[model samples]
Target: MNALNPVFYKEKIFSAAWFRTYGLLVIGSFVLAMGYTFFMTPYKIVPGGIYGIATILHYKLGFPIGMAALCFNLPLSLWGVKVLGKQFGLKTFICFILVAFFADGVPFLLEKCGHPHPYDPFQLQDEVLLASIFGGVVIGIGVGLILKTRSSSGGTDVFTSILSKLTRKPIGMLQMIVDSSIVLCGLLVFQDWKIPFYSWLTIFLMGKVIDIVMQGYSSDKTFFIVTDKIEEIRQYILVELHRGGSIMPVRGMFNRTEKEMIMTVVSRREMVTLQRAIYKIDPQAFTTILNAQEILGLGFKRLEE
Candidate 1:
């Protein structure tokens, strides 16, 4: 009944539509956790988040690290759902469970295959570099995929969202601040800097790669034109570019003259066609261009809405 309780605030997770969403989060988290336990953790590499903390604890306490990670994040997950919303919280829960399940299960799978266990490689000098790089890469891709689907990996993600909402700052910037601190803490306390540094590198790489995957990797250019021959330019754009355009009336700041301002979005390859058409219509037309990192829908390739 609390105003912030996710179940009370939003639709419950039991809804049929959320089943697929939860399923993907679970699979993505499992892949990430399995990759970490089998490939990276055995090398003693610390990943970002409470998982990193769990690794540190497991090394010291002699308990199951993955299990400890689940316990550590359980309270945060509950609070995150209550404060963030039920749908989001439920998704996070799915990710957490999957990650935890993988963490506990992967070692057994590796052991049954007669492969050297994850912890065994920690004793090897060569493992320090290989684990750091490979673990970072696998985790990065896994995390990226999860993020692309609009799910959180819990831990600092929940806190970062809370902070972003509270301060009205962008979530990306908040995430950078929080993750940097986590990596720094891991480096300082663990007395080993390689894993932490690699972890930071992995986080950045994952974020950029995921953004490209979800939003698209293509770039677009938007042009604003103030021209004397509005009708002529408009027709050229329509016939040649096969794109849409809009015209806005504006007054020149210095000349105090009324004019029609044209705006349109075009792919990078279409720049030459736009320029040729504009020059043909009015040689002296004032023009400005802006860069668009991602273009979607209509004539562009859009990530699923």
Candidate 2:
């Protein structure tokens, strides 16, 4: 009975986690589709991906953007599995399919219900810059959320991954090369320099927003303090700042003297307080402060999260 209880609870926890992941996946896909269907596609802003190529094709050939993207995505996903060996999991397959459905269905339903410009329902066609900015941000948020669940929408990334494997080049470089080539294709097809410029801007904003979303907006700072008053600084950090840190033995390069270095991370607000306290405790203390992009563990984000 006791063994069965543990097993049952474990299964329940697993089920809950599974549901949460898929929930985020669905929401992320919908949001990504909205960005494409409403903003990017209507304005002809190709931000460089399978969707980017689809946008160009939709404008040139009058094909459905979502259907075009799905056509590309499905084959790429299968090729990825064949070459990369099961790297594209069920979540990735489902995520892209959901994105394609939402992207195509929303505009279709809107048109059927009598909305004249189903793609640009809000009528921001003239506001290309605004569309680019918001589109990037929305897409970033969607991608970031999907990334947090450790799944991908499975498009150009798969192709780039395969290229990386074959060429033995860095994946980042390959992805940039692939995206840049696609952007150039948009320019060639559209024959407008402005198209590439706006597309590049969207890409830049998307990258920045993705970083912000994944790492969070908190401006946490990391501090490394070299001080004579190790015990006093340690006490202040532990008692006053209510933070924990590590102490390491160090040998000064210039002076060749043995010393202790304290390393800690704190919120931006707490950093100011700690700086003042450190100055008061040891005016001669050498401190190095750095930006802490993402801090996880005790007194911060949970390790499991």
Off by over 4 Å in 1: 1-19, 38-47, 81-88, 116-141, 147-150, 160-178, 279-283, 301-304
Clashing pairs in 2: none
Q: RMSD per prediction, one decimal?
A: 4.9, 4.6
Model 2: weakest 10-residue lDDT segment is 4-13
Q: Which residue segments of model 2 deviate by more than 4 Å?
A: 1-14
Tell me how far candidate 2 lies from the true structure as C-alpha RMSD in angstroms.
Answer: 4.6
The TM-score values for the models, in the order shown, are 0.74, 0.91
List, residue by residue over 217-288, the lDDT tens digit for candidate 2. Answer: 768999999999999999999999899989999999998999999999999999899999999999999999
Maximum-TM-score candidate: 2
Give the range of the ten consecutive residues with the poorest summed lDDT in model 1: 2-11
* Model 1 per-residue lDDT tens digits across residues 31-117: 678657755566566656777777777777876767887886788778767776664655677787778888877666767878675
Among these predicted structures, which one has the highest lDDT?
A: 2
Clashes of each: 1, 0
